[model samples]
Target: MAEILAFAGSNSSTSINYELVKYTASLIENHKVQTLDMARYPFPMYSADEEKQKGFSNSLIEFKGYIQQSQGLILSVNEHNGNPSGYFKNLLDWLSRLERRFLEDTTVFLMAASPGKRGGIGAMGVVQDILPRFGAEIASTFSLPSFGQVFANGEIIDQTLKEQHSEALDIFLQKLN
Candidate 1:
């Protein structure tokens, strides 16, 4: 069975994006799912001066290890001001320094969601553009809009949106098999 790592790109304990990622992971029938919360694996703000002096933080090292071990990835990132959250971007920078192609050979199902209409598409674009450079094969991408209205009880309630997400997940799972 493939081991897929699922995570949210935010530090908030009550992150809606995290909820969306976990819910999507549950849709997969035949995979081992490991969920990561950024709040637990905290890292200091990255800077050139910091790396020059202290080297990579243990948290970043552990994160890279997770990426290396996983066969697939399901990540949902939150948008802050039409871009990915600064914390996630910082994590990306640190991971890139550890290995240029940190997600090499892994298939990724990228997703984003928000309470508003745009549905975090801006943040999704950031991941879609960058992950490929790191050798991540994007199996599919999804964006959930009006998160509060469309999602309930840990499931997507809107029929059209649910079917769309299901199709994306099917494509991703096929790549895993």
Candidate 2:
């Protein structure tokens, strides 16, 4: 079975992005999905000086190891003022320093969700452009706007949105196989 890494780019305890990631990951069949909670793996803010004094943190290294072992990744991002959440950006910054090609050749299913009408497109766009530079092969991209209105009870409430999400999952799964 294919192994997939699923995570949301936020650290909030009740992160809507995290719920979105989990819901999407569940759509995959015959795969082992590993969910990553950014809140659980907090790290020191990234800095060149800090890296010089202290080597990569154990948590960061462990997280990268998981990425290396996974066949594909499903990432749902949260936006904070038209940018990636600090927690997710910090993690990505640190990981890039450790391995320039951190996501090299890995298939990625990129997604974003928010309560706002634009969803988390701001953060999603940033990742869409930058992740490829780190060698990510994006297989699909989906954005769920106005997440609070579209999602209910841990699933997408809007039938139309749910169908689109399912289609996205099919694309992701096809790429995996």
**Candidate 2, residues 125-155: lDDT per residue as tens digits?**
9989989988899899899999878998999
The TM-score that candidate 2 achieves is 0.97
Candidate 1: regions farther than 4 A off: none
After superposition on all C-alphas, the RMSD of every candidate to the true structure, in Å, is 0.9, 0.9
lDDT of 2 at 23: 93
Lowest lDDT block of 10, candidate 2? 21-30
Worst 10 residues of 1 by lDDT: 37-46
**TM-score for each predicted model, relative to the true structure:** 0.97, 0.97
- Model 2 whole-model lDDT (C-alpha atoms): 0.91
